[model samples]
Target: MAASRMYLSAKRAAALDAELMSSGGFSLDQLMELAGLSCAQAVYKSHPPESKRNVLIIAGPGNNGGDGLVAARHLKLFGYNPIVYYPKRPNKDLYNRLVTQLSNLKVSFTDDIDMAITETDQILDAIFGFSFQPPIRDPFVHVIGLLELTKKPVTSVDIPSSWDVDSGPPKTGELGAGFVPDVLVSLTAPKPAAKFFKGTHFLGGRFVSKEIAEKWGFSLPNYPGVDQVVELPVDNEKL
Candidate 1:
């Protein structure tokens, strides 16, 4: 209910991140850590450790990819075998550190996306976040096409890959080009594209300051007990 009332655009989300880091004293690394951990927790809650323990994480070259990398590490710790498929890795220290962390955890990296998809029970769509734009390029285009062919359930972090931050999914003839996630984990707050999501949705990122929430008019949801993630009720009519 509170999530439905607040929909952050790409610009607003960026501003919130900046404000949080500059004034709130939260580092980018800190946010990414919490975000990725929350995503892993969501997957663990949905599938559990006893069932469907294998996950395929598709990471990109941006902050979203970093989040995926972080999620892979946490997933491994949670007793799930997570394999990462990072075609385009960023040259930043943070990303490199994440890759190293995953490697240290013995999480293998796969070059064959199709094969990895077949072996895994669930897919983590961390290929793109709120910053992703239009006509998908290169290896990602091919990779996304392969993912579309699978019947496996996908859980997207922040926003679904290939989706417009403000306009939801891109039209592919009569259908949408983006991968429709079975579960969406929104970090900090729900983005505009989340309006199109019609599945289990969880709101993460508990580090947002009260000042930031009031300033941006973000309605924070209350997590039950000691849970790090809160499930939001989906509105089929809106979808």
Candidate 2:
């Protein structure tokens, strides 16, 4: 499939962002919109024809969480039941806007990850945007534990919460290098962290892929006024 592709690492993802920003004539908000809408469409297509799932989106306070909220709103429009789990306090006005949109749409909200896990058929991880770092803390650690227990299908936006995008390794005390998301979605670039780090201790497989491109009906790279944008290398194995 056309979507069977790969992207760059978190640093590369950041580089792409910088490239776009330096090019000018576009704002980061626009990119966020594309990521969110694209994610929503991908999740919609992944479900079965008769599937009426209770989708749970776990979001942090960063842009990653924002993307998850965007997907939740779209999922609601697509007739699926979507609930958003916000683990941390939102720090940005844009994040506030997302919360407001969710409220306006009447999408259910929760601060408790455990509650969300119990209720959801599909889990979307928007927590910890990218660059999985050291020291797993309170709620995030709790959420990861819940993810381990649930074993439900999970789709991570950008990168999995516990996996370092560049190394694809788990954080401290994390047995593996990263979270084992059934599907890891990359917005504009592939995360190199999903590759490079391979060991018996590591998950040692593709942590990135573009399978959503075909499923979500993204025929062309999405830019506001452009027919097509730049094309990078496809790292299917990494995804």
Candidate 3:
């Protein structure tokens, strides 16, 4: 089947997520693992390991960050030197376990985002997901500013950091002030902001049920063969 072109608003996305967790026979951990693995696969597919093996993953304080940590583990196994810059980590046991897993893999963690950005070949923006709002908070505001200054290629996890899930970025004078990712791995379903993303976009999260998709009007792309991540066409005209 062809991929669905439907885009979800932030509220609808959250509702679908809740419904999936409650009745879709999948746990949060399972979805996160799949999403993270798909994201790693997307990065690996986009930038060959022979050329761009040094990846810097910027994690936030939510499940999105946990996904990045999981991606870090998989990236390490995939022969990529993934350095994590997690300024704020959540206190949940699930997140702690993810950190432990990364430590077990001996993945390097850095407090310096700028240094990591300077050294790495590619970046994974796992800082925020669909629930983020504007008026950017503390250290993240500073971090986003630094990212805006850099020219390195970035692959955002679910949604680009500081981007509104329902609408695109705030209509300030600077349209591209924040981190503009070269690739986007949309978990579960693509948010409305994705329509404006002019990059190689991929749909992750393979656990969503047919019922949920139909009910929520999710136009999902079909994953090819054994691949877990499928690239979607970007509307370059919108860029």
Candidate 4:
């Protein structure tokens, strides 16, 4: 039987991540590779490439964006068309290689998100992750506006774009109003905000070991067989 799941706070989430890399001996690239691959597998299993082929991945400038970059590469290998819209990029070499890998795969990238959205069948909201906070800014401010206006199914990575990691969506503003994604892929473990998500929820990043879970004071369900991702039943849904 799968273990009972727990929702982690933003502070604990960051601490667990640090422990995974520092003490667990997992490299950043290794973790991102696992995360992005799991994300690709989850999306493929749920949406399928035959129906939702063209994916508009709105990547941000953080490690969250790096995950998207890695996901784009895997999605392509899975026979889906992935187009990336990375407005602001980090100066790190890891990010540079991710972009280069996507470019080498002949994946299309666009500066005009409007045009990209029009052409794509679905959207991947890899714009932000667990550590995000408060008021939106720059290109993303406009990007979030575009995402809200769209009818496309948005698959958010870790946390939905512009969402508070623990408090969930906004209260009285347009920042995250009615912006619930069609699919939510929670990495490592689900965040406290995941309670707000009503869509098909998937738990990926299947690398959490017994030690890490113990250290973090959390429990995680096992991934079925050799699968890198697993569909989690929302109590409201499977009941």
Candidate 5:
């Protein structure tokens, strides 16, 4: 259980992300699309539109945000109304393209977080990723703290926002890391922090080929058929 075969450290997760682009022959958009689709599928399976139709996706400024945008697009196509709240939008070309795609789909980008939180049935936390460091800053901190107060179910992308990738959630009762999302979607492979996550955990992003898995020293879970995401049986005690 302590091996890298199941749980990846922060360093290892970053290395695998780079290797996917470099040696794995995946372009940035390609990977983000795959990840985003998987995230959307996971959400559909976990919380169907009948259960929760309106979703509020809180995106950040990096690749994680790009993934959230992609998911929002897919979720809209899946018959769910998705409203995106991107506080710190990055000026990258890829991000611009993603936003344009979602905008074209008529997905709402709300400026009112409080209103969105009140009306939305669920929240997708994409405010941080594996490379995130401590001391959550600016609008992100305030937004994460807001999530902690919301009763709406949360589905975190990759790792929960503002959490340590390797060590899991903060123990000091930090406002930024206090919330435990109801659903967690682990991309590529489960990170070490996933062991601390108590929810309906899922393994999304089925883009990791067997070669890449072997190279990264993490065992990929069996994804049945053409499924984009697989629900992982998480036993925290064994983890």
Candidate 6:
């Protein structure tokens, strides 16, 4: 069930971007930061404290990857070594701050996806984020294959790569056959994409809603619903 009337949809998420640019006076970077920090808090709360555990963040080429990169930095600060894996070289917008942070921390980098996969204790699926529709192609399929092969504890930064945010898992094709996370660390509000699309058997697990988040005690300074980080705003434009 949609938590609130304000929940966001794919179309609405995009429109909100436009709305903010035109009226909200908020920059894309600021919004991205909000997403990143929120995601970090979700991660901290969902997983048990494991200073000895290693986390690998799979980054794509978009803003989603940028969110993962920010989380990686914070995860490191929280006492875990987070290694970020970029399938392709990240974009310039991401490179600006990402590179500086990595350089200062001198975080290890690897273009060879195979090598990075073997180095982590846990996996963070920052690969395709919300943009992924399903049936991953070529290189991505191969990378996700490695992740499945590892069978490590996996946590998606937002939504699992290519797993549709709504309509459950992709059933027709092999693009997103068996890609589910042990936990989904959502940002801002509950992603309809995350909630609706996560019921398939291939997903390999159940969802942990913001309500569950509250049970686990994930709270932040600027979070909308402190005790429970409610679902994303609904796509009212459609109604």
Q: Tens digits of per-residue lDDT for model 5 on 1-239?
A: 22234677889888788888998899989988998999999889888999999999999988888889999999999999999999888788899999999999999998888889999999988888888987888877778889888888999999999778988888776765668899998888888888888788888857888887877777777888999888887654654
For all predicted structures, in order, the TM-scores are 0.95, 0.75, 0.93, 0.94, 0.94, 0.73
Clashing pairs in 1: none
What tens-digit string does per-residue lDDT give for candidate 4 at 151-219?
998899999997898988877666767577888889888887887787888988579897787777766
Q: Native-vs-model 6 lDDT?
A: 0.59
Kindly report which residue stretches of model 6 are placed more than 4 angstroms away from their true locations once superposed. 1-7, 48-52, 133-135, 197-239
- TM-score, structure 3 vs. true: 0.93
What is the C-alpha lDDT profile of model 2 across 1-239, one tens digit per residue?
Answer: 13343445566556556655665344767666767776766566556324747899988767888878887887888788899888676667888888888899899988777767876788887887765565767777778777766767787776667776666656566643435776656655445554432211111112112353333233333333321122222334534
* Backbone steric clashes in candidate 3, count: 1
Question: Against the true structure, candidate 1 has what lDDT?
Answer: 0.86
- Per-candidate count of clashing residue pairs (backbone under 3 Å): 0, 18, 1, 0, 0, 13
Worst lDDT 10-window in candidate 6: 199-208
Q: Deviation in angstroms for 62 in model 6? A: 0.4
The regions of model 4 sitting more than 4 angstroms off are 1-4, 235-239
For candidate 1, the TM-score is 0.95
Query: How much is the lDDT of residue 68 in candidate 4?
Result: 92
Candidate 1, residue 77: the lDDT equals: 96
Tens digits of per-residue lDDT for model 1, 74-122: 9999999999999997788999999999889899999998789988999
Q: lDDT score, residue 30, model 2?
A: 69
Superposed on all Cα atoms, model 5 deviates from the true structure by an RMSD in Å of: 1.9
**Candidate 6 lDDT by residue in tens digits, 37-96:** 555555565554473357787877777888777777767777677777776765485557
